[model samples]
Target chain A: MKLKILKSYLNESIQHVSKAISSRTTIPILSGIKLDASPNGLTLTASDTDISIQSFIPAETDGKQIIQLSEKGSIVLPAKFFVEIIRKLPAEDVEIEVRPPFQATLRSGTSEIQMVGLDPEEYPHLPKVEERKVISIASDLLKTMIRQTSFAVSTSETTPILTGVLWTLTNNELKLVSCDRHRLAQRETPMETVGEQQFGNIVISGKTLNELNKILPDQNTLVDIVVSDNQVLFKLDNLLFYSRILDGTYPDTSKLIPQNFQTELVLNTKQLVDSIDRAYLLSREDKTNIVKLVMQDQGSVEISSSSTELGKVTETIPVSRVSGDLLRISFNSKYMLDALKVIDSEQIHLGFTGSMSPIIIQPEGDTKILQLILPYRTTN
Target chain B: MKLKILKSYLNESIQHVSKAISSRTTIPILSGIKLDASPNGLTLTASDTDISIQSFIPAETDGKQIIQLSEKGSIVLPAKFFVEIIRKLPAEDVEIEVRPPFQATLRSGTSEIQMVGLDPEEYPHLPKVEERKVISIASDLLKTMIRQTSFAVSTSETTPILTGVLWTLTNNELKLVSCDRHRLAQRETPMETVGEQQFGNIVISGKTLNELNKILPDQNTLVDIVVSDNQVLFKLDNLLFYSRILDGTYPDTSKLIPQNFQTELVLNTKQLVDSIDRAYLLSREDKTNIVKLVMQDQGSVEISSSSTELGKVTETIPVSRVSGDLLRISFNSKYMLDALKVIDSEQIHLGFTGSMSPIIIQPEGDTKILQLILPYRTTN
Candidate 1:
């Protein structure tokens, strides 16, 4: 491709596509990012086997010329070097020219870089998705949902499906759920959907969602999502992200939530987080990450953790409200801290059926989202 | 020890001493920070074999109570846990009490931590330095000298003495030098000395100096330094740093720098840095970190680097002045970048003796500091 493009525009698009270029790609051609220049603009694409990202730059943006094209052509440059070179280019405008035998030259101010480029035709084409079930959600809302639930996904690859967050659309509402055996996170929000259109059991890798979150707009804008049988596509303003869906049925988690609680407590979210965070410090030393919480007769909760070599940390925080049977529960403090951190509420409610059962936590006055952690069975 | 201390004061002191408590410390008692509380103040000390740092928090500072001593005693608490706990404590004031058998309880807000304290007597004492010949220098200047020279210290342990920066003081001039075979960095500044007080051959570990740099006052206050037979002591406002000097003699690098140049060029430091930085990126890809600089006939220099697999990057920068002889030299771009980054000058002069000799770099009009790098032999 022969074109002169603004450094800022090219740098932004390169950063977007670079996210899809994983170092683990075994195919040599897949390690490169493909560039296609046309009469309209320039398109940059980067992909591994699992996910692909493409960003487009128009000939002009907001009445300012961003690109001047001399010829329409295509070539693939190594993502690792190209990404860094563009960022460090010494001028506002960069001129890129491709010669025969796939050699590319990039010139910016006093710097010129000649790189060996690969044939764009050899790079794999992006998967085509049927746009029948296109759904749109606000970018910031989607980012928040990803942040809330994605951390709970199983990091282990043994059960690959469990490594993804399950996405389900029903009754004009979009819900996301992720569980990693020890803890589960779920979030739901209302959306305007076309008449009676509904789909479920679409699972996308938590890691992919995280990368997608980074590319999402910082401002509140809508992002359209298209789900195919085996692939999913997220279309933002000028960028497109495509990923393969996990091919397995997600476990039924509806029954995992306890319908009633024998014990319940409500406290300021920051105070509770502070109390448990201290316990987590000592718990992390023991390597079990176990922190214990016990209800007090004087309407307070005692949060504590002990290490065989380091002794113990005990935190006493008064509860705003308390009811049901007295109980003592132990759990992974790291998991709880992760869950509590995403909570936006000033106060949170905790529900427990018993010591060993799952403890349900919900933001105060918010019924659409919750987090659950399975308590550890401690002899004490 | 029983005391109520302001968390901010205690936290700052803890951070200063914590630098001496290395995780690699083999002695259990050395891993703990020794705390001595007296009517005057609370003293926090941490020591590894090579270095020891002590911070004293007075009972009152500037008419405000920083430490309220209830009883005078001493104890040693595990540095790893105490450092983190104090930082995350829930209150501005932290109360610490030591009971019989060396059990300590720390109370802050609603949080309480019970730690097993080691016997203070078991902790190794800090080295005693002879304070007969004490000289003082600006803390910021010492910090700057450390930053400029420390990075060149040999990281490899095969030559243990080379891991230290050599310090020489004579006629009110304090100079620091470090060399790791490939390149050498030297920085010198004049300080007021009392009656011919001079010391040379005092070498301190670069790692220890780095730790000291972190604890040095951000303001440009003077730090009294005492160089003893085997230890160097640095006295800050309320902090004391004692470091053991390397036993072996440091190699003389004075002869390595050329007294005259075959070719010389002067250019804007930032522009030269940017040009070479881009070349360094490509040089880094080749893993040799080799970037070549060639003097042009038309008052300019060319910076370039290449990889067999990735191609080449060339930058041509115009120089303001050129004199002596024409030359083409190659050196480690990373070393050049490190040396150039510490030059606080708008323009810098480059002096080259020949294609095979060391290239010297100095900030324009500054003779107090200089950097030297050996040229690499390359067939082109």
Candidate 2:
């Protein structure tokens, strides 16, 4: 394969694909990035056993030449060294030529580097997805949904299905739910679908979603997602992200969220976040990470935590409004902080059914994003 | 102790002293930072037995009150949590009050944090150095000297003295030398002395110098350095840094550098560095980190490295001048890169004493900095 491409374009594409190349892969060729140069464009692909990523640089982009190809061929080069060398090459354009017997020479400026390449035929091919079952969603909204729910996915491998975020689609409404037993996060949004085929129980690994989020552009570009029997493909711009779906049904988290609350309070999100963060330091030292919030009748809340060796911390933040009964509840501060950070609102509404029941949090007027944290039982 | 200090001033002072608080120290009290509040100012000190750093914030500076002290006392607080808490406090001024039995309450805005503190008497006191044997040097030059020579210090503790930089003072010139057997770096600068003591062979650990370098101001402030029997004290403005000197006579590295050369080359420092850096990548794959430089009579040098499995790389960078006999020498590219990064010159002069002898590097027309790297023996 002989091709000349801009350094910046290649560097960015390599960075995107490198995220899928795992160092612990058992297959030798899986650790290398497969490059395919054709008359139309140049494509780079990298995969581990679970996920695959491919980025394409067209021959011409917006009237400017992005890649110049003299021959069409394919070769696989070690991702580790190739990525680092490409980033440090001291030239604007890099020329790559693959000779027989799998020898690739990369030339840029006064530097010429020759690296051994593997046969591209040994690399795994991307799984094909049905085009008719594709669903399109805005990239910006998809990233937000991933950020809001992915953190709640269980990191423990004991329950494999719980390590993924469940994606459910009913007609036009799309719902994402992630639960780690201790806490849960769910986000619902309206998306455009191709047909009246309602999709559900499609669980993608939270780690995979995070990688997809990083490569997705921040703009409002449309991303088409196609789900096969066991694999899901996300197509954005000239990039394709494919991941294997977890086998097994996700637990129903809908029953965990309560519809009504015995106590409710609305407060400034920044103030509450800051107060809990300070109290968290002491709670972390106690090894319980438990912070108590005591709601006052006069529209104020006291947040406090104590450690046997580090003393205690107490912070009082005024609430904008209060209703129902006054209550004191203890919960993990880290869970609360994580939920508060993703709620994009100045004021947040917090609902508590009781000290032992799960607490619900939502943006003041938005019902699309909901966070639930289980309270810790303590003898106070 | 009761005092109200500006958050920024307190935070900066805490940061400086916290460097000396080693988390792995065996002494329990050594992990805490000692805070002393007097009528004059507030002092923060942290020690790790080997090194001690103290930063003082005066009650008033430039006619503005920096610390308001209502009571005079001292206490030791846990450095890890205290430093992080001070940085995140949401107030311009923080009020700290100490109760009986070393209970400290820190109040800022609506947040109040009570932390258990250790008795100040249990903390190790800073070592005293003789003021009569003191020398003065510019802070910026000292930092430069540390940077130029510190990287050559032996990280292996087999020879403790080799892990420290040898500080020699003759007349009014200060010379610092560091070597790790393979390569050596020396920097010389002129400084003023309090007396004609003409001190020599004061070795301070490279690790201690690195911490001192981090706290030194960038400006040309004068720093007073006092050398005692086993301790070196550096006094800069309101800060005091004390470090234990390594015991043993440093080896003489003067004979290692050659005054005569069989080959000479003058080239752009950045160009040679970039060329060697690229070659280093390939050499690293071979597990030797060895790159060869071939001097051409046409005023150009070819840098190359090869790996049996990963092929090879060759880069030819043009030099402005070349003299004496043609030469081909191999050396560790990392050592060459490290030395080149510290030279303060655009063009560098390289002197080679045959293919096996050590190569001397100096900034063009400057004698203040000298770097020597040993050549690797190759069959070719």
TM-score, first chain, each model: 0.99, 0.98
lDDT of 2 by residue, A195-302 (tens): 676788999999999988999889899998888889999998889999999999999899999989999899999999999999888788777899999987677899
Which parts of model 2 have CA positions greater than 4 angstroms off?
none
Clashes of each: 0, 0
Candidate 2 Cα deviation (angstroms), residue B292: 1.8
| Deviation of model 2 at A198, angstroms | 1.6
lDDT per residue as tens, model 2, B221-243: 99999889999999999999999
| lDDT for each residue of candidate 1 in B1-380, tens digit (9 for 90 to 100) | 79899999999999999999989977889989999999999999999989999999999988998888889999999999999999999999999999988999999999999999999988887898889879888888889999999999999999998999999989888899999998999999887888988888899999999999988877779999998999999998889999999999888888999999888899999999998888988889889999999888898899999998998999999998889998888999999999999999999999998999998999988978899899899996
The number of clashing residue pairs in model 2 is 0
* C-alpha positional error of residue A125 in candidate 2 after TM-score superposition, expressed in Å: 1.5
Determine which window of 10 residues in candidate 1 chain A has minimal summed lDDT.
A190-199
Chain A of model 2 scored by TM-score? 0.98
Candidate 1: list runs displaced more than 4 Å: none
Candidate 1, residues A1-380, lDDT tens digits: the string is: 69999999999999999999899889999899999999899999999878999999999988999999999999999989999999999999999999998999999999999999999999898998999999988899999999999999999999999999999999998999999999999999998888867889999999999999999987789999998999999999889999999989999999999999999999999999998999999999879999999999999999999988988999999999999999999999999999999999998999999998999989988978889999999999
